[model samples]
Target: MIRLSRIPHQLLTWGIPMGPLMLLRTRGRHSGLLRTVPIATLRHDGHHWLVSPFGDTHWVRNLRADARAELGRGHRFRPVRLVEVDDDRKLEILHAYRGAFGLVPFVRDAFDADAGAEPHVFAREAHRHPAFLIQPAG
Candidate 1:
């Protein structure tokens, strides 16, 4: 399934619109080299938001190991410091993600929230998933 996702990942990163797609480049925790993965992201407020989709995946682990990462879309790239958000703000970001993509089932199942649930409902289950606040690495 992941291998197949990479096919569309390449297409969306290069051939199609990048409005919802991005490349997350993290320094491999063990290998000490760059590792890039395509992710669906939403930019809200002043931060770029990314959900694990799957819980505590490799990329999430890698970024947690090293907050120095880059987010890219086609020709554009930005150095970002990833901070796991654990406040009311995270729910706001999560709500924006649902509103933007209507990826409710995907998110709900991943985070163990009910369909059409409120942000507060999901917020209670926040520890199951990680939402990052992408800040300009300055």
Candidate 2:
């Protein structure tokens, strides 16, 4: 979904200091073509996870169809497996994100704007959105 070439320089500019940038290579559900995206990451307890602020994007759908993906951080490439969080864990992750980033209000407002609904309702739906924990393959 994100144009990699256009943002490569900018991505590296911001990615260098704020932890490793994630490159997720996934297969298109309909077209069966491979798609890659660079995303921000949060590492929790040795596991890497991605939080979808805009929930259910094309890349997320690709991961759902095929859990196996290639992750590139800087020049290292590693194989990762996607683990989708359940409802309870998703809530926990959301809270953890809010606490760690201290961006609760911004997150809430963003979800509201994206969903075009009231903050309360959109917040609830955002919590239900699927998030993935990426584990390095053994």
TM-scores, each model vs. reference: 0.82, 0.68
Provide the overall lDDT of each model, using Cα atoms, as 2-decimal numbers. 0.76, 0.63
43-65: candidate 1 lDDT, tens digit per residue: 89866788775768889999889
Candidate 1: worst-modelled 10 consecutive residues by lDDT: 106-115
TM-score of 1: 0.82
In candidate 1, stretches whose alpha carbon ends up further than 4 angstroms from where it belongs are 12-16, 104-108
Residues forming the 10-long window of minimal summed lDDT in candidate 2:
112-121
For 35-107, candidate 2 gives per-residue lDDT tens digits of: 7776656666666677776677888888888888877745556788888886556655555454444454544
Predicted candidate 1, C-alpha RMSD: 2.4
Q: Which candidate leads the pack in TM-score?
A: 1
